[model samples]
Target chain A: MTSAVELDHVTVRFGAFTAVQDATLSIEAGEFFSFLGPSGCGKTTLLRTISGFIEPSEGQVRIGGTDMRGLGPNRRPTALIFQNLALFPMMSVAENIAYGLRVRGVSRSARREVAERLLDLIALPGHADKRVDELSGGQKQRVAIARALAVEPKVLLLDEPLSALDLKLRQHMRNELRAIQRRVGITFIYITHDQGEALAMSDRIAVMNRGVIEQVADGRTLYEAPRTAFVASFVGENNAFVGTVAEADRDRALVTTAAGPLSGRNLRNLMRTSEAVLFVRPEAVVLGEGPLTGRATEVAYEGILTHATFELDGGGRMTATIPRGAPVPKPGAAVRLGYDPADALVLPREGFAHA
Target chain B: MHSSVGHWLILALPVAVVLFYAAMALLDRRRAPGARPVSFVQRNGIAVSTYLVVAVGVWTVLLIVLPQLYMIDLSFRPRLPPTQMGGPNDVYTLENYRFFLYGSTRSTAAWNTIHLKAFALTILASVAITFLNLLLCYPIAFYMAKAASTTRMRLLMLMLIAPYWVNEILRAFAIRVLLASSGVVNQALMGLGLVSEPVDFLGLDLGLYAGLSYAYLLMMVFPLYNAIESLDRNQIEAARDLGGPWWHIHLFVVVPHAKPGIASGCTLVFMLTAGALAAPQILGGPRTLWFTPIVYDRFYQAFNWPQGAAYAFLLLVACIVFVLATMRVCRLSLGEITR
Candidate 1:
């Protein structure tokens, strides 16, 4: 099918301040797409633009092959789940879920049937008459989703709907959200600042920084092969080094660092023969009595793993997560750190920072 | 014309009352030492309790239930005359109320008839104004509340407040001038070529009513807007997310949340408009009359204080009844409506 949603160089500026810069992406039907960023990073702004709450300053937003520039939110075949999960507190759960259909002028009984089906689908089958405030956070979340789906929009836009819930509920709802998106087979564009939530649920994620998408890739690609130092450090803890690419030929490049020269995967897109940041995932770094050594700055025991932050004497920092039962490194203790050449991806010096 | 001991008693009452209250407060404190610091409590509480108790006791004998009783007693007495009271032969009669309630002289009767007729017209007019004000106020309040910054909202809010500073009478006068026969209003209409002749607004009820409503319309706007403003926009969005359209959002979401504001605005407008004197007197030429004017005539023009007091009392009862009916219809308490 037509890519579920297409944003082509969509730039949204509020006066002189650009909320979303030249951003473009394509989300296929049935795919769960997430825009992941920190607060003020423009993820929600992008989501609002897609939902037609805002118009792009420079380019157009297309959903299912139709331009969405001038359409009002209600006129579009799109629904947005606000960050606050804006449920009508005065309305019954059934009434809230049936809102979109009712607005579309569906007949009463037919709307009821659709609402009943949606309530069942969201797994709140008998909560039709319940007030929104009476339900728990997770229930409110599902009800919001059901409401958005009630309109049967081609794409559903979620602006941090799960952000308000506590950890366990948020975790549970992540899977529920993914399942709902799968069941409905609609494009789901979720905006969130929570890394774990994005990683757990998104079919593909566009990691954003300063109103720009740093990288868009599946969970594995994003985690294992982050294209920029920001993405590498942001997605997970990474041991990075200041280095200049010594040479490159297609896929493998040797980078010279202060500590020593190291072999690494060629981030050809972002690599240049100049001083750049090299990122090795914390898990990818192997610790043993070999190679270079560093002082352990801190250590944390997380039941499943022993994480240690290593301070390089020459320069830079690295984090290594070892099995829980593994020998715990005490603070001030020295430890050797090394990683596979495949784990180290050196990005061009300039692509790493927002400036 | 002064009663010697009674006047002296009234003057001395304040000091005597103060002493009694002080004595009572000391007794209360001795019985119940509160959790607050004793020194602070003794310092503030002594003065506050003394003042409060004395003031309440005196007011009970003065403002509260006394004025009506005094009026009733005076009504029984004849009109001020040296031959009537304690000096000659004091006598009581029901003739004042009888004569005033249904005027004795033809001129008095005509004025009394006009006064009684004013209430129905005022009530109808007030009801219409209140309803329309509620409608107009809701959207403005909603928009003001949603403004991103308090400063921006306050600037727009100043427009409403600015008009308030202009005296109601002046505003009505301004409107009167505009709507006068062969006045600016007619000039504008003629200038626009919409009318062959100048429309006469002076000496007519319609002109009076338009001026009155224009002056009082702000009263309705403030409360209804406050009600709409306090509503959480998120709730509306939530309803919309649930797929609700304009009607559903308004009916199931916005209206219920704003009910208290609407009721409060309506009640206030009803109360003020029913007894309104300023707007009607200034704007309403001769044909449009109001209830307060009737009460005013009885009090001053007729030299019949008892009948005037009775009419005032009747108006008070009408207000209470109107309030009770409004609250009962809304199925809420006055406290809930006001908040």
Candidate 2:
């Protein structure tokens, strides 16, 4: 029941506003893919388009290599788990799980058997007789997933399904969802604004902003080698140093900033614009002994890591995360910040200026 | 102390009904094993405060119990003629109700066919109206509650309410005029050559059906809308995404979710339509004689107060039975329907 999904130059327009523009990607069968973005960044829109709830104003969405043009959500070989779970409150868990089979005109006994099997798979065995409202938040989530999977869809689309749970349950359910996806071996298109969820669960992530996919790559690549300035800033917390390109090489660049010259990898080939921003994660920024200097403005104790925000002498703020037990500079103390050139990425600032 | 046997039965009847209700509630509670055994006051939440208990007791007696007791007493008495008004001969009898099943003592006819036919026809017509209202209102209610945008829903609500502003009598008269031989519908039909001549619409009882349904349209719409509006849009989407066709989506999801609204709406419409007098009188065919009209004639034209009260009580019992039966058929409780 699993298949690959491909989007070819997909464009969705609502009146004059383009929600998703020219999105082209192919998801391999059984891969866990996610569209990660901030709110209003078109990630949900893209997921809806793939699920057939929305028709693309411009291109084709092919599932299992078949063009899904003009197909309604019901006709598509796909199932979506809504953000709210949307479990039919009136029905018992077994009835809710068996809803798809019942609609397909399966025999009552056959539906019950399928529902029992799905219940066991979700680790919620013997929950069939219970009402949806009686289940805990996590149980309800598993029931929702079980409900969607009961249809045996070729592709399963989840729209921020874990957003409603408390943080502890959310983290737990994330692993459970990934395990379920692996077991089922269906292409899963997950949409989330939470980067942690995307990074922890997805095999690859498409970071989107303002109707455009900034980059699509594995979690490690997205974190280590973001191709766009928006991707670098959005996927994780980073220190951005706006400057001009002083020297350029095949894979490296020297940028002149207010803090003086900084050299880093040329991820986006910013030599043409000359204007670029050097991005370095707070962890990558070495403190205590370095050439760059700033005054520590704020310190936050965040369990394992102690974060210190510094007001740079040359310009904007830069943050450094020191292990909780390590020596941390107090607020108002002068500090030095530095990072190796390999840890910093030089991306063109033009696209990020509006963001 | 000098009250007649009818007065004692009137008081005793309510006590008997209350005892039966209590016994039934006990039996229902027993049927569900492992359920917590709750006393009457606790089950009704009347134990929460003395004020609540007193309020409920007073409300039941004043608004519900007293009126029925008085009506029952009225039904059992004979209607005193003008000469015998307020005299000792104004005593209790079963003659009023006997007139319904059997003809008057002077006639010796086996049964009263006219009143019996009127009663049967009224129940059938009310059932039809209730069924029709549901068929007509469900789609509109669903559209307003789930599909339409905020602005469009507001516009639709205004449209639903606009027709009511003209007043029911005037609206019924308007429909009556439309069903006339040379009215707009017939004229248009004849002009379009669909019919060679005007159709006698009133003779078919079409106008009465239309007017009664139109009269209770909002009663059906508002309840159904309230229930459907609270249903999560995601449930419908989830159903659709799972390969459910449109009818299956409604059958498995929307219909079950909207059961309370449907039950309440159908009950109210059926009850109101059964006791309806104006719509039937204004739009009914010359041969049409609804139960309410017969009761009205007994009370006013014939000046037989006892007979009218008896007929009215019988109709009330029928409405109550219909309401209970609907709740049972829909698998909804009174509390759920009211809510």
lDDT (0-100) at residue A316 of candidate 2?
Answer: 79
lDDT tens string, model 2, B21-43?
Answer: 88998898889888877665676
TM-scores, each model vs. reference? 0.85, 0.90
DockQ for each numbered candidate: 0.41, 0.74
**Fraction of native A-B contacts kept, per candidate:** 0.50, 0.95
Model 2 lDDT tens row, A59-165: 99999989999899988989899999899998999999999888888999999999999999999998999988899999999999999999999899999999999
Q: Which consecutive 10 residues in model 2 chain A have the weakest lDDT in total?
A: A267-276
Residue B64 C-alpha lDDT in model 2: 88
Instruction: Give per-residue CA lDDT, model 1, range A138-233, as digits (tens).
Output: 988899889888888888889888878998888888889888888898888889888898899988999998888999999889988787777887
Candidate with maximal DockQ: 2
Scored against the true structure, residue B250 in model 2 reaches a CA lDDT of: 86
Quote the RMSD, in angstroms, for model 1.
Answer: 5.3
How high is the CA lDDT of each candidate model? 0.77, 0.89
Q: Once superposed on the true structure, which residue ranges of model 1 sit more than 4 Å away at CA?
A: A258-260, A269-272, B1-113, B147-152, B237-252
